[model samples]
Target: MPTAAHAHAHALDLGRFVMASPSSFHAAAEGARRLAGEGFEVLSEIDAWPGGPGKYAVVRDGALIAWTVPEGAGATTPFRILGAHTDSPSFKLKPKPTTGRLGWLQAGVEVYGGPLLNSWLDRDLRLAGRLVTLDGAQHLAATGPLLRFPQLAIHLDRAVNEGLALGKQQHMNPVWGLGDPSAEDLLGVLAEAAGVDPYEVGGFDVVVADTQEPAVFGAHGEFFASGRLDNLSSVHAGLVALVQAAEATDAEGAPIAVLAAFDHEEVGSASRSGASGPFLEDVLARIGDGLGASAGDRRRAFAASWHVSADAGHAVHPNYPERHDPANHPLLGGGPLLKINANQRYATDAAGAALWATVCGEAEVPYQEFVSNNDVPCGSTIGPLTATRLGIRTVDVGIPLLSMHSARELAGVQDPWRLSRAVERFFAQAG
Candidate 1:
């Protein structure tokens, strides 16, 4: 177990990361900033690569890949890849989102993923994303709370307690204020936030987010709550582990360590910067070519490589215990969980599962298992997609969480550091 001070520090860092990242673009930028601070050289996709053991990273819009080449390893060496996504389920603004009804101004929003809609109602919301200027430069913007989606009073709908069925198009648009709504109004607000003129705001990729700050609570501050914990928590752990592994490489000539964070996993990961796309493969091939490795060598490396796919898993809910498997339930503050499914929803198999067990056991980190109820369908992560795409051995894993797709989610305070330490140990492995 970590000392009390170390646990508190890790929780504080996670809170700051969750509050700073309201969109995928912001999360990628944050990852890049941290990597650069740790002495990793940032590279462009169009540029040629350098040779031999060193720290390097590349960014493509909302996806990023960073790696540290081991001191005597060649391109044929296997890769220990840590995978996580940068996106969360939320309401994104359409290109022309301005509309008005009954003296109220509202922004037309499209549901981006499978979010708990009721959790978004009546909360103070803000807008944050990337903006493109007429000159072709991009800028990031995050404005304070500027919209509200108030719920209907129980007096108006007497059966509200029965259930709430919300219409995505009708009841989900959030009101900013009362006025004759115009695209210019929203554009002007975004332009000011990005320090550009309204005319210069030629395009935007924006999303609505809750403005409440993350909180750490429980009898001893054992749990923390925030948005985007589904994968951002994994992102943080991978990043910290990669940094530590880079600083102190294992002497056993381990494979190159890589951290790959993609953007659109929540919406199916089909975009240019998504896991289903060619970003990871393209970069891997480029690295192999740069190191003068033959095609056969690259193939051999793939056969030997392993990927750890980390996402947030569902913790057994105290209020709804029956929703989880009775014997395979994961709990808060119990370290990380290995997610499994017999239906191939997850990429874990006997070989991959054994590797993860060894890593955790060697690090002395307590771990748990999570398998959904037999009758209920299981959710997936990038593990299956990446394994199918690259033919690399992959295992699905994550920290236990509650209200996973809610605007605000819950997780253990200690699990973040536990997962990080386990990943560090994995990267330190020689095989």
Candidate 2:
């Protein structure tokens, strides 16, 4: 059981992490740093697996997978792997990006995920993510109050309230300020902001950020309003579970516990470090081979290994209940949502769902089921991708939320704690 103080502290700290992570790359680095603070060493699988007792990583720039070994043990065991993505729907800079002929230079950005476009209007925004300076120094910059998209005044566009549609390549672009516009002017502004010479900044991937501090909201403070919680909430849960499993014995007959967070999931995951690639599989294979798993033993371990693809779930919108399947819509503060889709957009199967039900029962954590309306298309996650790649049984689970792909999203304050507890219990069981 979790104490009230413990839950509060975890939720607060996790909220801060979510807010600070402006992009997937930043998310991965920060999470890895936190894990390293716990004595987890960053290692590369490109070299032979170290094959011993310690936390190591298979890192590919923004993407990373970190895990720890049993005390006084080696790779002879597999681990319970919890997977989540670091990417979310924000804007990315395009090559030769600049706009407004004069007195209105704005940054051009592409919608990363399928985000609700209008939610970005009238909000204070910031810029963050990794940038390589001309000096070859790797710097992560978090620049805020950097831009905004002032929705045309109602008077300017009377049809705005009646109905509005966005064109990603045209109208949705954010205008941060009013000044003489020039395609070449932005480099100067960025250099000034990053405290570097214009030519010294070689390249960057920055996005407009919501300036609202993440906090417990709602009339009773049950809701969490912030940024990037969709996956960070899941990452935090995975971390909590991995630590718990480390304290307990690795299932005498189970693989070691693992946590995998990859970047670029929002962009189709085609990168070398994404779920669509062999990072997860290669790492798992390394763990198996390092532990000296014979063909049969590794196969058995594969058969027994369970994965939880942690992501965020869509909660039925109070204002638009018609958009959800009556039997599948989840509500705020309900519980962990077991997401299912026959199209394989998600990886949950009957067996996987049932396994989570059992884990919830053990942890005494509440849970719910989520399915998008049949008439509408559903977004995808790393769940199915990882499941098919590793041939491992997997379940898709997450906390339900609103404005999923918006620059800022809301979730239940209670949900993160519940997820952490549930994942902890799940890993404590059969690997």
Candidate 3:
């Protein structure tokens, strides 16, 4: 178990990380920046890679893969991979975003994934994403509090208290300002923030994000509230663990430790930077080639590898206890979760459960099992996808959370750090 101060410090760092990452592109950039600061060399896909053992990181679109190869690593050395995603459910800006009616300037958006639409109402929001120039240069852009989705006044509809109904196309548009839509350009706002000309932005992928800063509230500072915690919590944990594993000097016999953060998980993860795509495979193949591994050696290495797929799981809500498994109630602050599903929604099986128990035991962190209620269908993670794509053994795990997929979600302050500690132990143990 981590001390109170240590847990608080890790939570503070996680808040800062989430604040810096408004979009998946920004998350990847921020991760790469942090890796570079820790003596990790950037590996460009277009350039040749060095075969020597060292710390290296690569970015592909909104995804990032980083690893540390030990001094004595060889062709048949297995890998310890920590997999997580960078995206959350939100509204994505559509083409011709500028619109207005009756002097109110609004931005056209489409629901990116399954977000809590009601929670998004009346919250301050900002636009963030990558802007690509005509020459194919990409620039990151994020604006301050700029847009808002104001709810209809209860006075207008006295029956609103009975039920609050919202339409995706009719009522979800967020207002930015009062002006003529024909005269205003929303892309110009992002371009100016990015220090680029709007005319030069040939393409863009922008999404709306909550502008409120993350907070540690509740009677003992036990609760953490933030946007994008659905999966950023897992990403931050893996990143911290990877950096710590790289800095340790006793890694002579340890396997290669990898942090693979993919994007588009909130959707179906079908993009090139997604887990279902070839990014991880391509990177692993290159690494194997650098190690001078034959097809047989690579297969042998993969047969012994492990991938820990970390994502957010549901914490038994006080008000909705019936939604979770009656016998297996995961609680916030109790510990990280070892997620399981009978339908293979999660990749964890008996072997994976035993491995998780060993890892948590080695880390001195407590853990809880999470299973969905029989009446409710379980959500899937990158675990099954990674296990299917690559023949490596995988486990699904995460910190428990309440209000998942909301504009701002809730988590226990200690669970994130606990997850990181367990991940560090997993990286240290030889596969």
Candidate 4:
């Protein structure tokens, strides 16, 4: 929490972005817009890799990757890549969703990721995702919107806490406005939002999302909460630093700025756009080529390049502090946490960890350490995938967070901007 005055001073427009990015497509679009506005060229994957000066972007189905090469970059130039994901855990829309219980029509939904099912109850949810539209049999366009997923009230369920359970195909669907909700009805509404013909909407991948936006909470607004912070917080940080990375790249390929936001990490990163797929490796290799790295040079260039996989770290919870490693209980607002998992789940070895610590020190950014107790199995991220794929040195680090996959998560407000600043410094000097 922060005081009102201090809270207003925070630079992040977290609220504007929270609901807009319910799906990775929307996230990619937003970042692409920003980079394009900065005069960065939005490169078409359909085109051959253009190894010229200036900036460029690549957009897959639901993912966007971008970068800026200094004016004189050539075969010897290596990129400084920053990686993060764009998907979040949530309830998703189904094909034949229609349920009526006591005159209330519920929309069908399927769980998307490892969210705390309990926390999703009794919240205002919206539906959002990409829609593919086909015209009279000829024209087609993509549409995206933030839609809703409503939860039942506690009063409706007297035994909510009495070992409450829900069959995903049964009780978890949400009831929207009053009436029978056929896929047609909602598709019409979506068509209106996108200025398309309802008949033109061929298919969609919309998901339920919290209607709430990110907000400053706590006494001084030091604490932030709303929806989709699990990774959007990092997304915001990455974009801001990216905008700045453009300026710093004027140093002649000293440190080329690369932003990697992959899709499908929430599920398995197996999709064409997923971290486990060719998105990262292909993009990095292409960057090597863009910088004039031949096959032999690509290998050597990878040796010198370092990657920072940005994700949220688990924070010490007030009610369950003991759950964390006693010696490394990362606290919120304690700066960023350099996550180290002894099992290599985090991809942060001594060299990687030391790299981050040194960056934090030089930037005067306060930081903490986090590692799950040896007794507790830990989660993983793109760190290992990137390390193994490119043979590039990698590290995992991020702001500490509470309720990682919940519709609404908590993080330190100051940390968001602090991290952007440090990452800016990193991309400016990673070489």
TM-score of each: 0.97, 0.91, 0.99, 0.91
Best by lDDT: 3
- Give the 10-residue window scoring lowest on summed lDDT in candidate 3: 247-256
Residue lDDT tens for model 2, 1-431: 45545666777988778776766667777777777776677675556667766666556667778776665333335457788887777777666657764477777787776667888877888777666787787667677686787677888889988997777887776776777665356655666766777677788876666778888767877788777776778887887677666665434554567888877887888878788887877777777777776777777777777889899989989899899998776887888899999888998999998999998998888899988898999888898888887777889999998988776788877788888888887766654
Each model's lDDT comes to 0.88, 0.76, 0.94, 0.75
Per-residue lDDT tens digits of candidate 4, residues 1-431? 44334324543475566555667778888778877888888877768887766788888867778887787676656667778888888876677545556666667678898887877777766666777766423222223323333455679987776777766767676666566444336556656766678676777777677766577768765788867777877777888788887876667446667888888888977889988888877776787776667898777667778889988889888898678888777777888889898788999998987888877887778888888977668999888888887788899988899988987888887777667767877787645
TM-score of 1: 0.97
**Candidate 2: where is the Cα deviation over 4 Å?**
1-5, 45-49, 71-76, 134-137, 188-197, 249-251, 294-297
> Judged by lDDT relative to the true structure, which candidate is superior, 1 or 3?
3
Ranking by lDDT: 3, 1, 2, 4
Model 1, span 92-112: residue lDDT tens? 999887877788998888999
Q: Please give the TM-score that candidate 3 achieves against the real structure.
A: 0.99
- What is the C-alpha local distance difference test score of candidate 3? 0.94
- In terms of lDDT, which candidate is stronger, 2 or 3? 3
lDDT of model 3 at position 258:
90
* Angstrom error at residue 47, model 1: 1.5
Superposed on all Cα atoms, model 3 deviates from the true structure by an RMSD in Å of 1.0
